[model samples]
Target chain A: MGLDQPLEGALAPPMRNGELAFEEPWQGRVFGMAKALCDAGCFEWAEFQAQLVETIREWERTPEGEYASAPAEQETYYNHFLAALERLLEAKQLVAGGAVEARSEAFAARPHGHDH
Target chain B: MSELKPQAIRAEALESLLIEQNHLTAEAVDEVIIRYNERVGPMNGARVVAKAWADPDYKACLLEDGTKAIEEFEFEGGEIDKLVVVENTATVHNVVVCTLCSCYPWGLLGLPPRWYKDPAYRSRIVREPRAVLAEFGVVLDDDVEVKVWDSSAEVRYMVLPMRPDAAAAMDERAVLELITRDAMIGVAR
Candidate 1:
């Protein structure tokens, strides 16, 4: 996902014919959550984008097995990404308050994990 | 105590005689599909959304917290290890992704459709959501900022797209039609 590529109205979709697509709606959810998070000041939009781009570039460059079995490295990158996601979701909920109980309860009903 | 002591037989002898057992529990992917087939489909979400559009209190409650709001219909993202719901209000919308090998909440949504787990999307969307959405035929206004989520672990997200005015009064099926997969993710109109 090159930030430089523009895909708005006048341009062609950036993806190639055989390139993978996203599940609609949910795909859009990615941007929506991020935007909401940024707007709420959870993090600066520019900074967030910069981090993701850097991470993506680094991963793309390294071979998958290069960091294999090294728990520290895997956790370092993956955990930071998850943390960012959590912040975004929290901000979105904060902005849209109401009927929060049902949502909270629904989430609670799901298996709450304890990391090994 | 006898001089000719009897040696103990190894437990391996007993274990080797037993037959191997198989499990009924489905793999993560299968379980994901089963849940999608059983619940968490558009109809279910539509019911909740319908309630929100019609009832301010419920909508407020849903906006405040989605997991509990969804339970009103006895719908639970079974086996979905994590659930994160994002609603699109007049001013904001939401989207989701699994940046590290697709750690999604299958419990809320059955198996992630292939594209979500695809390299192209997971690789591109986070960096270029605007361009990706355009590729998918969605054009966002420049002022309406787009946010991209990168998932790792069990956490997963769902976008509650703002109900389009044109979809008003439409049946659940009708309304869902307008809720394109991309739109639900918050990259489109």
Candidate 2:
């Protein structure tokens, strides 16, 4: 949402700092999904403080972006973030508190997640 | 402070010393980073497509809301304010081109791959989806209507190619093997 931040390279320093501190490297809308899901109550990522770090490390290993750093803990957390969410979804059976249900209706509430 | 500037000068001198010893090239260094981003950029989104195809509910959510659809994955650093995932279904097909400027979905997608960033590809794709795709070796049925999305302003799109029947039993990772970045932009079949 904010265009004020500088683009990567010859500009800003590395965005992730081994989990000590970091910036949101995503385009504005990528965040909207989590926000929308959060608003709907699919699950809040309050515990996601460390989750992002893991995800970053995962990105480093695959045929993805090869950062100068060995592998960031921040990325590793991020790499694991989805698994964490899925775990929560399975254990909680909750989507945005009950918002997951509404999101299920995102196009049309699946009355029960079944074909209409 | 003047003292601070002196300290900064010393730091630069020290950095230069390290650079000389390590055989580092600053200008070339940036080029390499950009090159890497180009190679792996759209592959991330390619994986997303595989996931959606394997799961029905995820596909519905993606069509309903692409931005949210991405959060369902582990990919990070997405620079998205808005996202529109276009599905290339049978009756209708979608091709993504950044006509005004290369506005890409960098989150689920790592970065804009090289060809998409090409001037020739950009200028021509919007004016001619069918023709351009043909160049990239992707031929579509003339009966299938092609919709070219000139991604500019407040919107960005990535194509969720209709899963090829050949990959029905494949897992998500296996399916990703079949999707090339060009397919995401509607250049390849």
Candidate 3:
């Protein structure tokens, strides 16, 4: 049978007139982070790719907890991208271990409606 | 505004962390984003498609070695090292997806469409191509064999769509305008 309904795991990316478009400021920011880091020679593009592939595989292997519940909002593709980027940075010693986690906590603790 | 999602928070955290450590500057990151959004994009792919339609020898070269032929454009970006150009024929149709992640020919087509990166598209396109293509508004005959190319880090793929008969009298410039990014991706014909 044709699977005509919306699939559970993946959400279509944000687009405009069939073109790649970012819906959120962070989506673009993370995308640029990965590309900029590669351009800066922190690691080869292939290295980042390896991390990304592994990250995605890990997600696929996951038993569909958070991803299954809120596929569109949680555990999105960019989440995998961020995970891969974080892993790469830590591996390359570009960022101190746990610094991202620490900083993320700080950002999360920011006042409600904080713009920056 | 709504409270930032954890993913967004993490993205910001990573950016600030990298900047604070001097590993990357916010300006550098912004510049890369701007370049992808403004400078590099599908026009390069359209030029390649148009040239293949206009020149037989160039078409042969493109079909033979996509990587080298695309290099003639001297485009800037990643994901063009080992490109394999697939031609759509009367009976064979080609569509691209990356089941693992979003592995696209960024140098040629720029950033992949969000739907291209969507997990549903990646998984469903391979298994039920005709149904998925129908959703994209591309309806193929029952006899047409649908072939899905799953892009990888090692090799990238771009479909060489057949020039529509309507463009038979059009010049290469006009034909180039007819080529859309989705056509090159084989989502639209």
- Better TM-score candidate (1, 3): 3
Tell me the tens digit of each residue's lDDT in model 2 across A1-116.
Answer: 12111122232322221221212222211222233344444455443322443443454466743543322233333224433443354345432243332332332311322322
| Residues B112-183 of candidate 3: C-alpha lDDT, one tens digit per residue | 777787777878898899999999999999999999999999899999999788777997778888988898
lDDT of 1: 0.47
> Sort by DockQ, best first: what order?
3, 1, 2
Q: Which digits, one per residue and each the tens of the lDDT, describe model 2 over residues B76-157?
A: 5444657888888878888888753345665555545445544467667777778887877778888999888877546778
TM-score of each: 0.50, 0.50, 0.88
Candidates' chain A TM-scores? 0.37, 0.31, 0.72
Give the C-alpha lDDT of model 3.
Answer: 0.80
DockQ of 1: 0.02
lDDT of 3 by residue, A15-100 (tens): 54455467676777788889988888888999989998898788777886225431243237777888999999999988889888
**lDDT score at residue A77, model 3, on the 0-100 scale:** 74
lDDT of 1 by residue, B1-189 (tens): 111101101111111111111111112223333334445444555565666766779877776776666665776544333445677766554567876665554444434545664566766788888788788776677776777766654455667778778776777677655654445455555
Higher-lDDT candidate of 1 and 3: 3
Q: Number of clashes in every candidate structure?
A: 46, 40, 2
Candidate 2: list runs displaced more than 4 Å.
A1-116, B1-40
Best by lDDT: 3
